[model samples]
Target chain A: MTTFFSVAYYTFIENIRKKIFYGLILFGGVMMGASVLLSVLGGQQTLRILLDLGSSAIEFFALLGVGFSAVTLILEEMESKTIYLILTRPVSRFHYLTGRYAGLLMALYAGMLAMALMHVSLLLFNGWVFHARYVLSLFLSAEKILVVGSVALFFSLFSSSAVSSLSFTVFFWILGHFSGEINYLGTQIPSLAGKLAIGIFYYVIPNMQYFNLRDFWDVPQVMGNWVWLSFAYGCAYSAVFILLTVMLFKRKEF
Target chain B: MLRLLVISVVLFSVVNAELARGFAYPLAFSAADAAASYTGLDIASVVMGVRKLGADIAWIQLLQYYGTPEKPLDEDRAFQLSWDMTKYLFGAKIDKEVCFTAGCDDKSHYHPQIDGGVYPLFLQYCYRIVALDPSYYFTYLYGGGALAWNLNRPQEALLLLEHGIAVLAKYQHASVRDIHEPYWQLNLYVSAIVYRKSGDFTGMLSLLETAVGQPDAPNMIKGILANIYQKQKKYTEALRLWINIYDTNDLSYRRRAEEKVNELKKIICINPDFSIA
Candidate 1:
């Protein structure tokens, strides 16, 4: 476990060295800045626009960072024979994989922190004190990053870096909003098989909506019973994904 | 003389016809001038642009018809200018009709229901705006919180206000400073209203304190604070603030304060040792 953590920590440091992290941070800052300009468009909803742009930008850039870092971390190391040097030592494949996963997770955590700090600084600068829920959102955001990181790590085992990142990220993004749409569609479709297939898929896929407490936090409303259940679901799904990745990495030739 | 007389009649008929068509801008300007003493861009930049275009077109038509600048100001031209200005400000024919309704009763009823059949069409329109830009706190604040809350749809207001705050939080965390402030204020305001309405006085007090300090804090918020204090039997403080409001520049707040003061004074007179007194 110590070895695993050390490896993960280093991997996270390596990801921070990449250009994409800086790029995403810059992009997010610019989007937020643009909100002031958008306010002149005559509607009294400038803050709303700013909030939407800021949140969407942060979510997008964070997801991008996680996907890019997780995708390339293992595959690049493997393709360049860097993994052999690491693995030729007394370290096991499990340690290597776990280390890499931890590192990516850490990088994602750091990125989210930086982004969150920037937003908070803005609020403080504007003389608006922080709300308690904003702190909870940080935890929730981190949880989301964990889920995102797991998907990318799992997909990287058998696939190319580009494919792994794209596939998993797309899957996460689409599936995040899929449950609600699928449930709505369930009533419209006439065939029983169609409904059954959707039902099966629903169970098979992670219900991303479960992690969404944005509705609760925004409105100062309490999260429903399902929010906690969703956390449990996320943990279970992440665990299974990590286990699968470990097994796949252990069986690989190089 | 006969030829001149015939031409005069023809010009008069043309002018009357144009007046009947509603191009009356001079009349609009005169009416607008009478309404207020203040002078600024009260019509908005977009309306100004439309007015310029209409005026230029009317002038060109007047030049062509009269063949000189010496012709009397055409009533038809004035009507055309007013019609063009109204069109520019209001948009299509249907919009003009809707906007022209005396008290918004005709316009408010046209909203369509979604799956649940809960809200009418206009509410959906406001909801769509929030959906398109969840960060826009004003829509949820004024449109959802103020209007919808007054309309007795607290749930919907809460939902919108929640989403709006989430958007603000997301951006705020993302380092978007501009949205972070207003949204924070809006969140405080909405939550305060909800807490007050739900009779959660302590929670409401906390929110109201935050709200009064916000840049977008309404003048009426002071009244809410006073009421809360009054309910807590802090009559001296409430009365002090209420009296200040009566003496303040915000005329809209004065009447409410006066009424509250009168009612409280009457209560004190009726019951010398009343708990509130």
Candidate 2:
């Protein structure tokens, strides 16, 4: 456990030190400011508008940061042969990959922390009410980042460059939001063949929309189970991707 | 030992937050961005005072704010926001996507959605935009037109159009502003429809009067105003405008004016002061 954490700690620092990390953070801060500025266009809807903008900015920038970092930290290390340093140590490949994933997750959390503080401050400054549900929304957003982080790591193993892996991760992130509708269509289809084809498409996709709490920020129906259900779903989904990533990494000559 | 405790708590808190997240789904603080009393408009009020340019930027941000919709759950709401925001801010007419032409009876005519909840804020947004840049003419046209035609809230639409007319009147009269006399008359015409809907007969006549009185009123204005009076059964008033249009000799309106003048002559001859309504 200690050996695993040591790698995680090292990877976390390396991920945070990147220039893009700072850039994403800076961009996030600017978005927070913009969200507050745009809030007034809302009239009586200002609070909901601000909340949506603030949270979305955080999610968007943080997802980018995670996607880039996941690809770069893993793919770059393998390419440069620095990954051997950890693999040759007491750490196993599973631990090494898990550590790297944890590290990237931590870096994302740190960024999310910064964004949340800025968003909360803006909310307070604007005399907006604080809803505890925002924390859940932010948490779900972080979980989404983690899921995308794992996806980025998985894609990096097969895809050659950071760009390709990041691209795949973003593509999946977008497609996952449509998973619910696709799954609904599967149920609607009459043929068993059609249902199976769509069912496979539905489950195979990460269904990242499950973690989308932004839309449901105000709506209450069918969300009673979101807390445990999304947590289990996000964890199970990310774990499967990470396990695949670890298995794929083991096959590499490095 | 204490350091370990701090780390343990940090990890536990992270885990607990997720647990509560699922369990709480939407906790108290998340449901509403604020209590009923706490609105961000107060902050906007302050920002507009200090940052004049920021207000302009804020207007853009407002469009951005409006365009950004939460998803999965907010798909409908956000979709409306983007649709309306585009139309209101940019003057892009958004046709209802679901409408079908003649053969399909059920979907033949499109009824633009009127989200009652979102309707009230329409005027408020347009007012703020104009307040920031008083000369921004499109805001008034698009917002006022939307309120009247789309939202079916004619009263609010009339108020917005009137405010726009008032703001442009001085510059419009001087022919200095980009807003021309036709634009003024068009706004009044839109207001006239609102007045007609609200059962305000005098208001509708007043609107037509205002349009007809414009120095640069279109050559057809007298005919149009006369037609309105003819429908109201005010043959005397109708005759007067018809005569004015007839004197213009604008071929497009002359025939209609002459026909209306003859029609009104017969009516006035019958009673000398016949006012059907």
Candidate 3:
């Protein structure tokens, strides 16, 4: 456990030093600030636009940060022969992989937190009434980013190239948000094989709709047991991908 | 590796199913109903789970379309002073002065021909907007009110309101037996439009009064009710509504409200206690 946390700390420090990390954080802040201009066109819904657009900018930039970092975490190490140096020490592959993932998540979430702070400040400047759901929405967004990072890491291990891993992760991201449509299609299709195929796709992809709490946070009676279930689902999905990533890493020649 | 892969797949399927059973969203991604220009946006918003942002874009587009001066149908007379252009440039104050200087009577100035024209694509814009984000209550209110009163198309307004109510029903709690505020507000708009369609002016006026009294009622509704009171010669009531609209500080209505309040005050000074029903 000590080794795991040490590896995590090292990875976190190293990843934050990259220029792209700082660029993403800067871009997120600029995006939240730009929302003020966009909200002008919303007429009476200026505050709503500010709140929605700012939160979306935070989530989107965090997803991009996680995707870039996760897909490159292992591939860059292998390319630079850094994995051998780490493996030569008294550290197991499980600890190293989990630690690297934890560190990647830490850096991405730190960036998200900075963006969220800017968003909150902007909202307050615009006379936005504070709601507890704002925190819940940010928390759910972090969980969604975590799932994406784990999936990207798994793809990096299973695929041959970082480009392919990134492409697969993005494809899955789109499919995940479309899971509701896939479920609807499963019921609408008449053929048995088509239904089976749609069913498989539905279950295989992560359902991003489950984490889209920001869209309906104001709705009454909608956040009962479902919120907890969605959280559990995010954790279980990430764990499955992480475990698979470990299995793939164990078989590598390096 | 193969055994672990199988285990991962099984675990993923089980967890996903459990969440799927308990979770329900009020989204129905239907590209069939959207305008051709907005179909791509509608699909992208649903696929990317950014429906609210897409709706905002559509809302802004609608505002721009309605806010712009309508083009003249006759090519040769296009540059001449179109009524909409006159209204856009001078607003109510200068437009009224221009009409009076041109020897126009009060009836002709106040009641422009309802059948002179309508915005052809207003209902289509409303449909495209709500199709992207059905929970956008303002679209329903603004679109319905504009259609029924401004465009003289109460039937179309009722149609839009019905669609809004039906779509919003999906968000209602199953066993709560109580309606949400947006849904109830929409029903109120429907009844007011119904009264308007039947030419029951008193009924429509009373219903609108009730609507504007709600805490969440929009300034647009207040403006509409004030105009109605002004038309009926109820100067005191008109002044009260205009004052309320000015206090809201909504930029879209503030200038017009200020003008109405000043104009109504002058009319009331002549006969301080006089009011017509």
TM-score of every candidate: 0.52, 0.52, 0.86
The CA lDDT of each predicted structure is: 0.55, 0.63, 0.79
In candidate 1, what are the lDDT values of residues B186-241, reduced to their tens digit?
66767766876687878978776666555455444566577768788877667656
The runs of at least 3 residues in candidate 1 whose Cα sits more than 4 Å from the true structure, single-residue gaps closed, are: A39-49, A186-192, A224-226, B1-124, B130-277
Interface RMSD of each: 31.4, 20.1, 2.6
Model 2, B60-112: lDDT tens digits are 44344333422333777567755654454333444543221223445433322
User: Which DockQ-derived CAPRI band holds candidate 1?
Assistant: incorrect
At residue A232, candidate 1 shows an lDDT of: 51
Model 1 clash tally, residue pairs:
21
Superposed by TM-score, candidate 2 places the C-alpha of residue A113 at a distance from the truth, in angstroms, of: 0.6
Question: Number of the top candidate by lDDT?
Answer: 3
What is the Cα-based lDDT of residue B192 in candidate 2?
Answer: 75
Model 3, span A1-254: residue lDDT tens: 99899999999999899999999999998887788777776667778888888888888888899888899999999999999999999998989999999988888888888888889988898788788889988888888998999999999989968899999999999998888878898999999999999988877788898888887665545666778777878887888889889988988987
Ranking by lDDT: 3, 2, 1
Report how far residue B97 has shifted in candidate 1, in Å.
Answer: 30
User: Which window of ten consecutive residues has the lowest lDDT sum in model 2 chain B?
Assistant: B27-36
Q: Write down the RMSD of candidate 1 (Cα, Å).
A: 25.0
Give the better candidate number (2 or 3) by TM-score. Answer: 3
Better model by DockQ: candidate 2 vs candidate 3 = 3
